[model samples]
Target: MEKIKTLNFAGYFRNFAPILLLFFITSTGFAFQDDRDFNEYSGEILNNKNGKAISSAYLSLNNSNISTVSNTDGEFSLKVPKDLMDATVTVSVLGFQSKTLPLDFFKVEGTEVRLIENVEELSEVTLYKATNARLLVQDMLAKKDENYLSDESIMTSFYRETIKKGWTNVSLSEAVVKIAKSPYNSSKKDLVSLYKARKSTDYDKLDTIALKLKGGPFNTLFLDMMKYTEYVLRDEMLDSYNFSFDQPTKINDRYMYVVDFKEIDESDPWYYGKLFIDAETSTLVKADYSLNVDDKKKAEMMFVKKKPSGSKVYPTELNYQVDYAQNGDKWHYAYGRAQMEYVVNWKKKIFNSKYKIDSEMVVTNWEKYAGDNWRSENTLIRPNIVMVDDVSGFNDADFWGSSNIIEPEKSIQNAIDKIKRKLD
Candidate 1:
């Protein structure tokens, strides 16, 4: 549970050496807002005790279905309908006391919310004689139908992927997607169709080589471990990794079982991470994992699609995180993030090129829909296609209409303003 928020995009450039600015740089899109009937409120959630950012805090309208999670930087944006202006909003994070206030609280006070840590009474734990983490995971999968989403549903998600060359934001691609999530019992994959997309890239910043993400949103969705149990928790695969239980914790007032895992078999490449399971139902609450790239050559083959033959490419880090939130009886996918860093070395170059790729998807809205409505045609994107190249330019302010989106940071907002002026 002590994972670091590594990829803070706003301050990414400041951490490294100065970037070589290109005169003809490409800009981004605006922080979309609807002026007619909705008021968009932006805010940051922080720990009241230390003032540190509380990443991934969930905020929801007290009586409405509208909600959004705070990003890695503890920032979140929500558009309140004119009628709901007087409604109360509740913010909750694990191990912290929930905070409730009127929507006007943010409107007047302007956006910094501090939540106090919850003081829990510790009780003595009685350990069972047979404590098998693998068996518990198997039980989790066995009860998936009861604890997880078993029926097909449509999820409105906001997806974004950004590429950074050294300290420069070389490319950024974003899309609002409609996901046809399949039932947990089926082997069918979730389908993603692009609803609206926008992108901007500076080829010169990336050293003339386009840094395209493979599978894009599809990759992020698979990070939902419960949906793709075969990727890690299969019966046969259980023997390949070592699992042990750690200290128990609380999430949303319920206890959780922390199971830490590591690869024991070195014959094949694998991932090592921890799984947070709901103690009451054995449901997968959250997963934070990273691939073990001990074998660089094999790992490179798995990640790279195409590059200059003379150049050497390898991945240094591949980290992933996924969170699921409860609605009523079943839990559904909430948020996912993947961050990877790679290095490229040319035959006789003075400096090796370093690039970081970050992709994240958040479920903004969801509802029950017919499974047969899944898009199966040409909606699927290929691995070779650069997502930015296929998307439309970020030239429209009303790009999303009334749909909700993860609020962009100040840096992104400034870039969008500059881009809109250039277009004008």
Candidate 2:
């Protein structure tokens, strides 16, 4: 029996050896450190024209040896080595003009850097003329191939994704997902699976898949909407709504021609928003939009009687604020924040749950292949899934029992695999 148990353990390890190797490699390479080799400095970066805080602006010192980006509030903390006191700090945003300052110029305890917007031909222009120009551009864009609007196939990268659930306003459970190329054959076989610590087991050897269908959520809701320019303006799902360009603005250093979309018909979905497209590449950069849902009406009509007693009825509002950044030549979604507001009415008891979801992806590496052996070579890279337990706002029983759980890595890998199979 002891020998049999040992054999079983060995077999398990063998099955997951590739995934284990990836976890070891990634953990060692991306470990976080608390101690810095240099002293840290704090400051705020703002736009000189409007004096507004510039978020996500890249700042580097001593020729990129030390670098950081400003936070959403335009605040930054960076470490500068004492030896490089004379080195200048450079600040740059996408579409915006870059600024540099000598380290010696800042003598106070903290520094405030102001960046001025580069005057482009569009900056001093009137809104009405810009709208006309943008309308013409949109008309041209809508006539292009709709397929181009939603091609995530452009993203060819290896990344590890993590997902977690929150309790008491903190993450309670977590999971890690890793996807990399196979060693023996890179094209033919791609492995995918999930790991759960609560189960003390790993789900391995699942095949990677992609979606080929044109109208799925991955294509329609995300990719196509993101790659807006790929579709001609006439192809937009505007119903009777009219879209016109407003003004050219800079976001994250990228110049975006802001397009206003409004409803001409009340029957059309509430599609009021602005699309930020890269001025040079014409790629979609960011979209800020909102949608309305009558949750109370839906709940009253759709709720099953068997659900939890004292269940609440609520009016739900879904808000999505999404941003995309250019990764290489393609535009990939970098970060997204979604908020669902539910106004609950439980037997006249009213409350609200502002559920928020934040997600981001960083592509560590990408490789493209156009050969016949792509499928065979794809098999070598195995997927690794790590299940993490959420300890926050949990009783010992809840923590041990498995009531609260999350499987982020599995979901992400599944998404990748689905896309792959569809494409294949």
Best by lDDT: 1
In model 2, which runs have C-alpha deviations exceeding 4 angstroms? 1-53, 56-70, 73-114, 117-224, 227-236, 252-255, 264-269, 279-281, 294-309, 313-316, 327-330, 348-424
lDDT tens readout by residue for model 1, 1-424 = 2221121121111112222211221222222336577777887899999989888787877666567788767888887778888899888777788888888788522599999886754223442222788888888888988888788888878887877788767777788777788877778778766666787766666664666565657667878788878766766778888889877666666677778999897654577898888877888888888887668787666666466666778787888888887778888888888888888887878899999888888887777865453554325443223454533356766776756677665555655665566567
lDDT of 2 by residue, 190-264 (tens): 232222212111111101111011111111123224333222233454444566777687765555677776556
* TM-score for each candidate, following the candidate numbering: 0.84, 0.48
Candidate 2 lDDT (Cα, 0 to 1) = 0.39
Q: What is the C-alpha lDDT of each candidate?
A: 0.71, 0.39
**In model 1, how large is the Cα lDDT of residue 384?**
25
Q: Which 10 consecutive residues of model 2 have the lowest summed lDDT? A: 5-14
- Report clash pairs, candidate 1: none
Indicate which candidate wins on TM-score: 1
